[model samples]
Target: MTKWSYDTNGTPGLDSVHAHALVCVTFSVYILAQVLRRQVRVTGLVVTKFFMIHVMNLAMLKLEAGVWGLVFMTCTLLYFYETLPVRYLPVQEKVVLITGCDRGIGHNLAKQLDQLGFYVYAGCLQKGSEGEQELVRNCSSRLTTLQLDVCQLEQVENAVNKVTNELGNKELWGIVNNAGICFVGNVETMTTADIQKLITVNYLGPVNICKAFFPLLRKGKGRLVNISSNAGLAPVPEMGVYCASKAALATMTEVWRYELQKWGIKVATIIPSGYKTGILAYDKQATAERWWRSASDAVKEDYGKECFYAKPKTEALLSPDLSPILDALVDALLSKSPKAYYYRGIFSRALPFLYLHLPTTLGDLVMKVIGDWFISKPLALQKSSKKF
Candidate 1:
């Protein structure tokens, strides 16, 4: 290969390398100019002025192709800069109500919002619970703890009334429907009552809360943030009821968004991947044993006891830090323009994309492969067949 050469003016003297670099830089600048011009149409005079300044700089540095490329790249960066989600409204004058503040995300978020100057109504199932006590100990007068059980319509209505009384003339800026529960067992193992409880707490709870708080939200032109799960987007075998409940809530949120938009109330759903929360901090083996024992004799016979008893080797996939989810919730409540849906945690966004975009057969195959790898096979079957 011939060595590249450049003249004192920085123009290509001889060699294909110099020529190729010049061509690449020229092509990049042309694309950048077209993009900037289109952006100018949308962004108006500001982008036009910025684009013209870069164009002038590029012309002045024509001999220095590298400088030209850098200038073009900077313009492209500026084009996207305007799209960043950076707008935030004042929280000091706002009042936000958060359910499930006994622990986990709700507890942390209530404290955070209170610190950020919003008057926070921290709703807990047990008024004197450890989590509630800790919140009271740390939070200032701005944070008020309320005994709220979303599943109880009377309690929800009473909580609404209490908030209304507290607010008086001030509007309720937002409501974070964070209360939920999970029951992990196969569909065959789950009883009718189990399913009902899951749906009642996870799905209908948010629905009831939203219906009761619509007037407050409308008055403030505020937000409705529902905390869903990654399981809602895609099912896991043993978590059928939990997944179904979350899926229902996610769908309900979408419908409510459309209906509530006319009243200037924003509805947002946060579908988070597994995080280290009290929800998952349960005795899986004990729960599985109960499920196995409760299952019908015929069902037990069909699926062997060893199969039901064998615990899968579940890796610790829960995120320790809850900031990503908390940040998303804050954005939903306080951002000038919030997204309809916010997905957090590992594979939260990617798995949904694959499920929605992949071919049906391919998606099914991928799920089967994932189940085989992650879900342990029955110990008895493995011993008999010498295969997993």
Candidate 2:
């Protein structure tokens, strides 16, 4: 290290360095603030103010304008970036409906929405289920839980009737299509019934809810947040059915944006990678019980289980936190305009990014390798254990 010379006055060497670092940090934060100008003007201005003093002092420094200018310009351009805003719209107390409010991401979302001061209207297949009842009891004062299986037209209609009657045809600020089901099995082994049930629960269920609630949303001039998946954007091996439904849902969300924009319905799809939610646990338990059964021992030995069979232990996966997503959903519901998609968590984003943008061959190679990695490890471990 170079020996530090004393300051002209009494300031220490470390203090000078700290001052310089503060200037650099201030400049950095100023640039970041410029990015938020379009989304939230006041917030961006606050960031600009944070860096002003440092930037003014540093203006006399012998730094190259090219470097700082480039940083500033890059941040300016980020305002126009295509991704969803980190902070969307302000939270407001407006009527909201969310399907699949019993458990998983939906349960978390409902709670968070309620906390955020929205008039939450949660829908479930059955109201009296232990988990469902518990959620209903603890929600905010404005919450209304109703038995409405999106798959059942009568139930959906009944729920709508209740909302219209109770709220007196008040507009709905948010609608979350969170209802989903997974049927895990090999494509070769999956029966028609398995695929059908998954499709009904994942795709048609959302569609039915949308159809029923579109009028209320239009009246409220709110947003639609669909809980799609990274699988919807990029396929998952051994999860063809789940992927298909989500893919369809993603497609439908896009179309809805196009269709409903004139009606003041902002649409957003939350596409996350596989989450370590109740869904994954349920699938893992079900897969363990039946995937290897009724199958030839030769098939199990030669082909082994799929990579997704080991997905439950995926550390990168985030458990559903109703806060961030619920915040996003509420924001989307209130935004005058919204992005097509919002992504969160770790692999939830990176995996889909690679799959969608990579060249077909390269993408296939990566996916195949991931597939083999997840599929092979457990089988290898099992075999080694057996030998011992």
Candidate 3:
């Protein structure tokens, strides 16, 4: 915007003649020095400087133009900050169907996306569930709630059909496979039904949704977002079944990433940490409650109530708030070149990268320290042999 002598566009050209661009370029001169001062790695310095330089150039243009320059810059930054699965598969005024929107992270995402102006197709287990209805009501013009149980193909198809009718063969944005469940227990005591339930709802559910929606997504060149967890990376103590399901999902995302990349469709696995939502609210206290009741039930045996409920391992839970995690997932869904994996959570950044980089034993040791610190005090799990 150098008040450039471009003479043609009436705007400072982004070239050798522009002093503003030069000023913007000059900002990067000391960026490396600033990074070395902070002892940050040159790699990080490179990324930070790149973004900063873009911002500076953008700000200069904003001053040169009307407010649109700033708005465009903000939007551009956000666009690059995330990757989505719809480059080759493009959709206009497209629809996105999300599962498990009745509660928890799913509900949060449904609400956020609808507000962002996408035609949000929400699939929930039950119609008029209080939370689901609230979101539908709030989402208003952009939202549509369909009753869907992912385990049932017919229900899924019905929702798809409904969307098709509304869309009339229009391209679809695929599905955000977000619904999932959790449980806590040693694998020895874990029931087959429980394991199957986790697999059904968490693993098979996404596959089912993907299979049914691929035609639509193929048309739209859409993306599929698999909401996974860090437990998928480092297994959790009591949530053996939960961990298995997410780990299965992580592998599935990788496979889908390779398989679907050619179709102009992208599959992104958002492996985030556990967050507080309806499910966490249910699981956090209910886990302890179940332990309490089960302890009462088992008290008559040798290992009494104290061993189960009062043990230190069950005391503290690692659940963080859901807002940030949900925001990240929504962000990934909107990205134009979504990645194979995105981690979202405070601890998520370090933990999963560590899982990929650290030596197995060292990673386990770090995880073990986490296990020892985050759980209820006087962890009874310490007496056990199984690590996960």
Candidate 4:
């Protein structure tokens, strides 16, 4: 065997290993350049950038020349073909029920679906709230506002019954389990009640709604879309509870898809990057104050008040526009053959891609670096380190 060796000029010679290494380095540099050039919008699948990334990946795989490389190349080609849209379902005959229509993603999605000619059942937390009223005032007669609080079984049951009665001959074509909330605090400081509240609203709420509406979905052979977060795919500090709930939702979606395959019902999970949705707190200062007040004295002392109270210099890096997420939801609902997972928004695909595809150790290192940069150091840690 010819062992790997550097040439007399001290350059990496044209050996297979060296060639692969060179390609990998070049690929990394190109990706980084694109990321910077696009001002952090590299994740958007703009035609040119999308093709460039795939072409570069193909080049690197070709240089490596292995069975695994060939497999990846084949998968890449398949994905490229799968993206081309064709043969959409007729919206005029479809009816969709979307939870959390009181605000945020669900509210917008309900309006969009209604405009697209789907009879929309908009589930609002309150019967006469501004969101519900707005939908009633603006949307067509095809859109109906239902009083729904997913956390309550009674409410979910009531909504389902009403929707069933109104459908008459039409089956419910889709159900979007979009009612969810997020709480950001260290797990150690989070109260048991808070943890339970997060689980109930984020996880169990969807479960209850699904079970109640399953029969209708079967009748229609409808689509089930779960609005999950990127946090579920890539867990992070200060969001353990939220992440766990969404992770559970995502897993359940997969299981339901398999179980419901006999009924011809499709299941899709929309994993979106952080967006300025109603689910999140825009008033960071007020949120910090609430969390601080709720913390126990011992917990407060350990982490210190400054750690919890210091406002972020800038707003959280959340996308103000919800269009990316809306697009994904529409695709999942309307596409003739929907994807099992629709990763939308900036960093939504990139985070999961890195976590799932990279070697475990390398993935951990990258996640650690990202966490360290994004998360703040506790004041208690600084105090303890100073003593040492």
Query: How close is each model in CA RMSD to the real structure?
Result: 8.4, 8.5, 11.7, 9.2
TM-score of each: 0.76, 0.74, 0.68, 0.77
Between candidates 2 and 4, name the one with more favorable TM-score.
Answer: 4
Residues 119-196, candidate 3: write the lDDT tens digits. 888888899899778986788687888888999999988877887788865568767898887655444343456568
- The local lDDT score (0 to 100) that residue 232 gets in candidate 2 is 81
lDDT of each: 0.78, 0.70, 0.68, 0.78
The sequence of per-residue lDDT tens digits that candidate 2 reaches over residues 350-379 is 888898799999999988776553344445
Worst 10-residue lDDT window, candidate 2:
76-85
Worst-scoring 10-residue span by lDDT in model 4: 38-47
lDDT, candidate 4, 119-150, per-residue tens: 99998989999999999999999999998989
When summed lDDT is taken over every stretch of 10 residues in candidate 1, the lowest stretch is 38-47
Q: Is candidate 3 or candidate 4 better by lDDT?
A: 4
Number of clashes in every candidate structure?
A: 0, 2, 14, 0
Prediction 4 TM-score vs. true: 0.77
Candidate 1 accuracy as TM-score = 0.76
Can you give the lDDT of residue 189 in candidate 4?
A: 59
